[model samples]
Target: MSRTETAARVPTLATVLDVIRERVTVSRVELAEATGLTAATITHAIRELIDVGFVHEVGTAASSGGTPRRLLELEPTACYTVGIQLDRFTATGVVVDLAGHIVARSSMAGAQEGEPAEVLRFVADHVNDLLATAAVPKSKVLGVGLATYGPQDRTAGVLLTAQPTASWLEYPLTETLSEALGVPVLIENDATAAAIGEEGLGGARSSFATVYMAGGIGAGVVLGGQPYRGATSNGVELGHISIDAFGPACSCGNRGCVENIAGPTAVVLKANTIPGLADRLRLRGDTVADFERIARAATSGDPDALSILEESAAVLGTATVSLVNLFDVARVVIAGAAFATAGPLYRDAAQAAVDRAAFMRFAHPVVVELSDHVSDAAAIGGAVAVLRRSFEARTARSGAPAGR
Candidate 1:
């Protein structure tokens, strides 16, 4: 090829990879056609992907004309990553492969009252155990990705102004985890992590913008295919968006914040006051499970339960509509621990609210949906964060000299 031709050929393999990630499997000829590249160029890219263990020859596809073509697809196990989602009740760990499939997962008691060091040590131990079970080589393992509750120091990788977990203040999470596990660590607010995961693995993949709603009223935003972190990485705190100025105060010190009215605790607290729901659902446990039960009963046509949930949904939906107007997102994914029960109701209500209130009503319908798998979206997303960065760095340094 001439110098000008080579110069014009930007290393678009990453873009091609993104395309494949967003679609079902396809063959080289199809890929070449899709990207408007020559068959020979497609062959070289596929071979490189295969060499790096990122793509594999899955099987043969039915022939349209002459002969069957071997199918090339992502090798889910080419590399692995660790994803951890921390919450007030539990800190969960998962091992995910290149394709964002969870290979193994385990959970432990969350930090109740303890030093940050001890809590993190326990988390590290769980991750180590998961890696061993997955049997992925340490060399092939990508960095650790943390999905944590805020307020967080995203730049410093510290948990700040935590909810009653005073030990979390200014804790250097990335540094400590790196030292313990010998791997690079990336941390983000739990909502942002969910949003990233949704963009990569959920309905958001098809849409350019997404408003990712974490269960129990919190939300994260991804605009124009990028995570929107605002000024200080504390962006998209949907839970704290004010819904009522004269309502109860929220943990973020705001009266009538969305969380005070719409989070799982708030909903469950409301249910406990309702005599019929309290007796029928036996909503005594202060855990996500109890919240899930409340949501299920509400969706199943329990009057008292429905009343409690509808009120919360209206407040949450109002906040979500505001987000839709601000971001002009095309899709919204509701996920997290809260989806284990009442996802459908929230999806419908939020969709309706956005359609009625979003400023861009005439442009397009803002699609609202629930996560495919609520059980491990955060953990899997955590792992996705690692795999994404690992491959990105690899793709970037593929042409650069080592140690430069």
Candidate 2:
């Protein structure tokens, strides 16, 4: 059964589903222990769920001193969700089962330069293609979720103002796509959703923060296993944080923001200033691609390339130190498209910086690590966001005490 979103309105159903979903598999006794729900409540709930074809009995579990009882697990293939990572240049899609495993995935380019509707049209096509490719029936598909650049009104499913573009401002992204695809749609900032993805399935139960770098740098600080989305769901604007009072101007009307000094575009812009470097590297206009080329040169012993990376690293380190200090978080995860190619470099440089500069370095000892997986974090996060929302909806429906 898909435990995608849970609402608290249905207390018994939500509590029971929440326990089963999180534990992966559980018997009545284990479910009781995990949810603090009594045996009768679990018994009644499980029977109802099984009757509705949501949960299934899958044999029995060994007991220490008692008779074994039936084990239950979510039927992953029973439902699916489509997740898309929408970027300026490309859109990547992934179809995930109820258990949040990617069952099918694909990508297409030539999206960045189009109009808003045009871009979403292409995305809709891909969504259809993804479902077809996965061979998952539409009835079993829960919804479509999108992870896009931030500064959005998540409550309204509207893309708000953001860097490098004004076209998407106040655009009803979710509604547009939902109407086109005929499926419920959900949207989230790529950074926040990616953090949620990591928290949900990356197996980390502790409070932490994730710094995701794609077209630009952004952050998602997860506290107590939930994303700390501030007002308007635009919290953790780590890239816009000012670190260089005298640095270059940013599109956000700020000077010396991290995006201006440490972002991929910033690195490319600075690389252009190196004497004869642009022509030597055959510099391309694509900031991310150019940055990757530069990173490769650095690894291959190019002094200019190495210097550029080091400079970018220094600025990023300074900004990261402030983030760790402000949050008092001990674990920092560096992620996003930026790390797709130069992951090790980012991990090493960021780790060294936090070790050397973070406040309470010895007391808390922040540890910086690369994302366990890269390339499609945002897309995966998007799908996970849908499941999580469903989980919440079910919980709300359960009519249990709020957050109980």
What RMSD does each model have against the real structure?
5.0, 3.8
Q: How close is candidate 1 to the true structure, as a TM-score?
A: 0.83
Could you tell me the TM-score of candidate 2?
Answer: 0.88
Best lDDT among the predictions, by candidate number: 2
> CA lDDT of each candidate?
0.72, 0.77
User: What is the per-residue lDDT of model 1 for residues 1-404, given as tens digits with 9 covering 90 to 100?
Assistant: 34333322323354356556656588877787776767776776677678788888878998778989877778777778888987675567888776657788887666656677887898888888888898877787778998877778877888787554666788788899889999889887777777777766644653333333343345677664456777887877788888788999776778988887888778878888776777789776655666878878887888888888788778777887888877777788887767667767777788889888888889887888877756566766677767666655654555422110
Which candidate comes out best when scored by TM-score?
A: 2
Q: What is the lDDT for 254 in model 2?
A: 89
Model 2 C-alpha lDDT per residue in residues 1-404, reported as the tens digit of each score: 23322322234464566567788888998888877767776786787677656689999887677788989988878788888987674457899886667889986663455667778898898898888988988888779889988777787888766433566778788999999998889998988877876776653435777888877888888786667877778988889998877878877878899978888888899899989999898888877678888888888889998888888887777788888998899888877877777777777888889999888887978888777756677788788778667656654555324333
C-alpha lDDT (0 to 100) for residue 229 of candidate 2: 75
Model 1 clash pairs are none
